[model samples]
Target: MEDSIRRFFARYEQFFLRALAGEPDPAEVAGLYAEEFIAASPAGVKAGKNDASLIEAMRQGHAQYRAIGTRDMRVRGLRLSPIDEMHCVAHVAWRATYLRADLPETVIDFEVHYLMQQRQDGPRVFGWISGDETAVLRRHGVL
Candidate 1:
């Protein structure tokens, strides 16, 4: 079960990297999210009620940046508890270095918390609230 959880996270991380690199199709990314997933970040809320809405919401947010890059992504902590036979609740802490086009090579060290539901297919990231957004914005003089 631990191995499966690790694999799930690893796959999700790869999808994120691909998204940042402009590789995956929007539908591909949206498919990983649950139908009722709701993700909140410093930017805004993304209520994924359907694949098209979710993809559009994500694209709109990504459009704010000319480019996005991430490195040194690591899982700081993970706790998974069973919610049912087919689902589990996952609380995860992740750390990474984020770079955006507007930052002019400035790197933002970020730590984010994710509340997810581990389904039979994979983990659905329903909640994401970054803890380092304020500091990152301040460092970049955006705040």
Candidate 2:
């Protein structure tokens, strides 16, 4: 079970790296989540569905990140706790680096907690809670 959890998140980390490099086919981002999921943060809590609209939103998000001169979103660490045979919660620590010609390169640290469901196919993120990304970015002058 530990092995499976590690492997799952390892692939997730790769996806972040891919986002900066402009790969993973873009649609692959939505594949990280389940059919329905909940996202919570300083902004508010919202329910989301993995669909075409979500895919388009993700594509736009990639563009937005690129526009901000995002260099890399790297996973610094991860801890997983299995809730049951089919459910797990993972806390991922990240270091997001940004670089723009006009500003000094900045690196921000943050963490996100994810709720995952495991099935015959694989593990899928069904929910997540994140920190104040907007404030963090602004503090680093990336906003």
Give the RMSD in angstroms, all C-alphas superposed, for model 2.
1.4
Residue 86 miss distance in model 2 (angstroms):
1.3
In angstroms, what RMSD does candidate 1 have relative to the true structure?
A: 3.9
Model 2, residue 112: C-alpha shift (Å) = 0.3
The best candidate in terms of TM-score? 2
lDDT of 1: 0.60
Q: 50-104 in candidate 1: lDDT tens per residue?
A: 5676777666545433234443345667777665654565666666555555544
Q: Considering summed lDDT, which 10 consecutive residues are worst modelled in model 2?
A: 22-31
Worst 10 residues of 1 by lDDT: 64-73
Q: CA shift at 48, candidate 2, in angstroms?
A: 1.0
RMSD of every prediction: 3.9, 1.4
How would you encode candidate 2's per-residue C-alpha lDDT over 1-143 as one tens digit per residue? Answer: 55666787788778867866877565766768899999999899999899987777876887788899998887889898789999988888888889999878898889999998986778889999998888888888999
Best by lDDT: 2
